[model samples]
Target chain A: MSSMVHHFPILLVAIPILAAAITMMLRSKPKLQTGFSVLASFSLVPISFILLMNVWNSGIQVYEVGEWGKYGIMLVADLLSAGMVMLSSFVSFLSLIYSLDYIEKRSLSTYHPLFNLLIAGLHGSFLTGDIFNLFVFFEVLLLSSCGLVVALEKDGVTKSTDKLEATFKYLVLNMLGSILMLIAVASLYATTGTLNMADISVKLSAMQAAGNLPWHVFAIGLLFIVVFGNKAAIFPLHYWLPDVHPTAPSPISAMLSGVLIKVGVYGMLRVFFFIFTDLHDMFQPIIIVLALLTIGIGAVSAVAQTDVKRLLAYSSVSQIGYVFLGIGFGSLGAIAASLVYLVNHAIAKSLLFLTSGGIIHHAGTRDMNKMGGMVNSSPFMATAFLIGSMSIAGLPPMGGFISKFTLFDAGIMGQYYKEITIALLFAIFSLFYMFRAWLLMFWGEKRDVKRYGEYSEHSISPMIYMPIMILALMVLILGVYAEPLLSIAQATAVQILNPQAYIDTVLTRVVR
Target chain B: MNNTLLSLTISILFGIGTFLILRRDIVKVIIGLSILSHAVNLLIVSVGAFSGKDVPIITHDEVASTNTIFIDSLINGIFAPMLNGTNPTQYVDPLVQALVLTAIVISLATTAMIIILAYRIHEEYGTTDIHKLKRLWG
Candidate 1:
């Protein structure tokens, strides 16, 4: 039993993928399929936790799919991946449970399989050893998510048609990204002659020091930035997110905003710190400019949204900017803050979506104009929503405030003046949008009364309430007790900055 | 030398593809995407430049070794060896091949998805002009 602990990283990915297959095979029985999905989703938590503990005790863990010379694929559990695994797995698990009730009214044929596949793909993306394999995992996630969007569209023909169009647009743009990424990977392989990430890093670092022609490396690296930027929803490349996110089912929106976009961030870090650290100085300004723009645009757009879900969607784009800002600072402190903020945002944003699900469920509309005085009516739900909002807005005693504060402090300490200015501006903009949400939904004279007016004053269903409550509590806990999370993030950041540490671990069997 | 030719052709295709992608027509965009994708594929394959080889496998039983066992019989080969090692230093970079194969599959998938998206846009809006679909733009 103890010996099996080493396989946890692979298991995190394998379980969902195998479950997806098993679920598809059991399509004749929806109950069995849903049960298997829930079981599979639940199992990821323990596996991720065990791996997290192992990584905490030891250093990073690596699972080469086969022996390196033979298979050339590896899955590693470093600090960054382990932390993301825990967040993604927990959110996926909770979302599945939430979906059990939420998806009952919706179609089931494609939902369960696609949902599980998306989880599998996300897990694979986080764990993958080689760049090309990461792209494969991304494509799997993208295709399955497209199916998910169409599956959850409302019954009206026009609305469904609109959703279908938006979903197609998302698919096309993502496909464009995939093509560009493949080109970059191929170019890298051509130059380096190896697909192993650690090997490429070492080779590229040597080439940089030798002062040889570095154009191939730089060109490929730039292409990757553009490709991952599209997926990450950076300011200029974020055209698809607001439309696709709101059109999907609420739970799917949570996963896309919470997990999918983060995959892009994960890819960026893997490349930036591991494969391209030597070039960081050259690229720092470019990254800072993009991050600042994404932050400003996301906040401003979020403020103008009347649709509750769209507002949350825009807020996600804004919050994603902070993650980028943290990355732009590129110090130990900045990286740690970014990691902590990533986890916090995942929880807070998912909580917001779940609460929106409650509102959408009760009100049957997404317009905030149609929702008023719900705070007095369903105080439990309203309060939970406020908690998520405040956490995202960086208010005191909540997780977002501490995480963003550390990020800004790190930026200033690093003397990246432009990024600091952007952070301050985003801070003010975030407060505006967040409070605007509160004022419109909770404090107004009861105006739109159709959805919530009919319901008796009672507790929200436990199925829905439990996840949001847990997330809300986590937001507070993450704010107050930042040490444990910070340590995990710090360890991950250290491993990323020092690529040799990761290379030595994964290439344990490789001879110099 | 041959690689340079392939590289030039690919760059030309890529340039044209980018132009098409910027146009408003959906079909042109797809064609542009395909062109860019093929150009990229060409560029990647060319990165592994293979020089004096007749398709690597030598015999049914033995794979091509890095160092050639046979010597030129006329002058230097009866007592001396032409190749230094059993395995040649230059093999078709297997890593690039794998990356290319995966790239092809991903690109194919993306192409299919884009085509479907184009069809859907045309069906609903009755026009493929991107400007007409700009409902949310400021």
Candidate 2:
């Protein structure tokens, strides 16, 4: 068991790659592929949980690929990485099952493989100790998601032209971001002569202590905002997300909203908290300003959106702003609040997306104006979406409330009064937009059947509803009993803010 | 002088790439991406830690013998091989080269994906102009 624990860090990434390859081979047998993909994705939940437990029990777990120690690529699993892996795996497992019924049969052949590969990329990006390896994993994530976005769906409701255009924008912007990342990474390597993140942290701090740290290193640190900001879809960089997330098939939308954008937050946390701790004072104001802008833009744009999916996509942008706000606060409580906010948003947003899929399917349109009084027809979807929207609106008795409360509490505790006030103002925007969207869809007069066509009376498959219900239940449970999640998030925050544990583990490894 | 020239060249390539990407033509944008990648790759190589002419590779025989004179004289007076066995700074840094190789492969794969996507976009819209492709505006 102990030996197996050592291998968990690599296996967390490897299992998905191996499964993707196998799933590709079973393309002729999609049923078998579906079963296999479900099995593989669900298996990740336990593996990630066990890995998290191991990290909690022991210190950081470092696995050097090819036994090159710090000289080679290393996979490091700390509390935060393991916790994220656990969250991603759980969300992915549910999304995969939802995809079984949600994705068209024709697309399943490539969808399963691409989805697994994306998971592999996500795990790899989170666990890798080498910054360059993180870049590689980012590419893996980018290309696979590009493929998934253009994949064909059953009803062909989402036009291929739109998918292609959104993907084009996504690719072009992200590719530019990648180039910036490469330049920053290359420059950092030139300055530090090391690629291992832990080694860089140690070397950089030592350099700072000696008063010889160069100015460009700070530029490189800022460059990360472009790299990860592009990923997380913050403020100016968030244009592609509202286009792309809404255009993808629903399960893919769930995965994108649930886990993919969080990758940016993870990168920001890892790089800022661990690698660039000395520059916190310099970075704090910049991050705070960006966070406020992100919240404002996402909320205002969401109000103007008529497309249900696009509205949710814009809301994702707003929620990510709150997470960044917590991060910019740079306190133990603030980081924990951010983590809690992140987890709740992951659950609620994915639930909302999956339910929106069902709603769109039933209504035969993506426009909220075309969808009215859905509770008269698909009550289950209406209820599920209500739960999700209420949670997202930060209403009481939902997980979103707890997260928002904690975030605002910590913001006050840290005494960022003006920023928190502005954030709270935008939080009202969140409430207004979310409730407006909900009221527009579920409470109004049923759209004249003669014009928009009658809502589909056909019952939704359990495969679709089951995942939504599960996530909805989780949102309720998390809100009602927030202790365990909060504690874990607190622990993860402690691990991130203090990098000594990570540095010691990665640097002291025996070279094979 | 060489460093300044290289930096100037990289900046020019980056400027050109940015300009092309801003154009309406999809093919031009892809060309811009390729050019940008080349610039980045060059930037990595130029940042290599050593100015020595010798390759980074060291033979097992060289490791076993530890004859400083034999190894030091192989390269010219630009940089001498440090035989102290404590640091290997004399040889060119191999890590950046390896990273550049990975970056190249990644950019290659991305370029291919983007090109195919462009072709598909062109097929779908019957035009490569990005302005005409705005069906998803808020």
Candidate 3:
């Protein structure tokens, strides 16, 4: 392989950092800054696609910083992280483009830099092999996201004070989680004598095989779960999510809900599959039970929500449950199912949030009860919203159907009969709430909707439509022809299962 | 004995931190996070303890002769280190120290950010009680 290929994994993160710095220098020129940031985001697509393709064949690629030995910080772009990078790049690019016409130029310039930084952070969290580096990236992403949420402080709805308060709560709780994770990593390292993931995995297995497992090792793993669960918005630990996600700008919401929470999922899998593979029996069952409860509670809560963004926020909670359900099962089929669901949810849910942004911008309210027959006024927005709804609802001929079906099938295949049964039942409930929000916003007789000064006549910008169209088209294509995507997910799942492949590739000296 | 003492102190701090987090005050929360960090640092440093030896550090050839979990091959052949093939005094678990250092930095950064956020909340809302900030929910 060419030495240049090694630069791709870290560059996925570095490019945006470079872009943000250049953006700061160009800050006096807002339009230019916005243009530069947009160009930078679009550039990530090719880089991400290339990395994903490399990992698809190579299994995993480790890029150690400074050409340092195995003891130093390493960035491993395994199949799983590579795929997430690809999805995140596509979503962030589209979201940036969408923001062009939707937000004021003054706000867009500030927002776009932070947006690029947030994506960079997401890529960092995914690629970093050192556990502590993950914490650093998590903070970077969280702080930038909070900055964007307060960037445009509306007077009443999502006001500055409320945003600050909510962000503070989110920060405090997330910091608590991060502290726990650090403690866990410290404890694990003390016992295992290695910070490299592959090295730790080998040592952990030997400890277990020796029948001398340290009690603190178990505590460390549990602590990691709590931290990751908080990020993933798992039910018991998800109190901050509903408050925080919708409090941000709609484009930011798409990124947060679309990409950020999934980092939690990624971390959980990394710890479980990569670092503590021997502790499978202790952890997997707990995850499965939690998945069941998370799904039930998230769906039940979603049905009762009245605010459009809040409802989508709650729906995200329910949708993430599907991801956990597949992960918990731990079979080849289940992992594949979960992988498919992850991509599908990122697109469908983000589209829903973006459409909600359009609705709120035009209608001047987030309350679904206040919205009426917007379909008559904004057919394109309504149609896009319906397409998003259908995909998320798992209707036939949509990406949601394929992913959800795979998850359910995998659960059954793995003898998780109850899980599959419950998932199917809640799948219907998800459709109900999605359509309920849809009807209240778009289907009723036109009422006295508070129009927001005719929307700059820029609602249909190519940047705005491109993300929606690309995602919508992906949904349709994946629904009809899921073979290629599933194959990619399948290869990734196999890599995740036999995490030795990843550990050996990164920690051991490869024979030339 | 040192290991036992270290474990006890870490556990105690963790307990106190947990209790503080349950309280309503924001200041208490910051203290709770700090206490938790120190507790982790203690737990990490204690994991490398071995009996009848000072902390693992190389001073000279004489110091390198100390019995531990990672004695050199030649010394092990002569003395036969007690812990089976594992020498009891050759290597310090450098991993824990590295983790502890990173944890300290991360917690410090977060603590600083938390204080700023608290000050901002105090400025904007005139109070820090989360229960009173009821604009978004419901």
Chain A alone, TM-score per model: 0.96, 0.99, 0.95
> What is the lDDT for A147 in model 1?
79
Candidate order, TM-score descending: 2, 1, 3
- lDDT winner among the candidates? 2
Give the CAPRI class of candidate 2.
Answer: acceptable
lDDT of 1 by residue, B1-138 (tens): 676688789889989999998898888888888888888777777766455343443463342443333331212212111233433334333445556677778778778877887888788788988767765432
Interface RMSD of each: 7.2, 4.6, 4.7
Misplaced by over 4 Å in model 1 are A104-106, A153-158, A448-460, A510-512, B52-90, B135-138
In candidate 3, clashing pairs total: 8
Misplaced by over 4 Å in model 2 are B58-89
TM-score of each: 0.91, 0.96, 0.90
Candidate 1, B28: how far from true, in Å? 3.7
Ordered list by lDDT, greatest first: 2, 3, 1
Predicted complexes: DockQ each: 0.27, 0.45, 0.35
lDDT over C-alpha atoms for residue A233 of model 1:
94
Better of 1 and 3 by TM-score: 1
The TM-score of candidate 3 is 0.90
Q: Please give the TM-score for the first chain of candidate 3.
A: 0.95
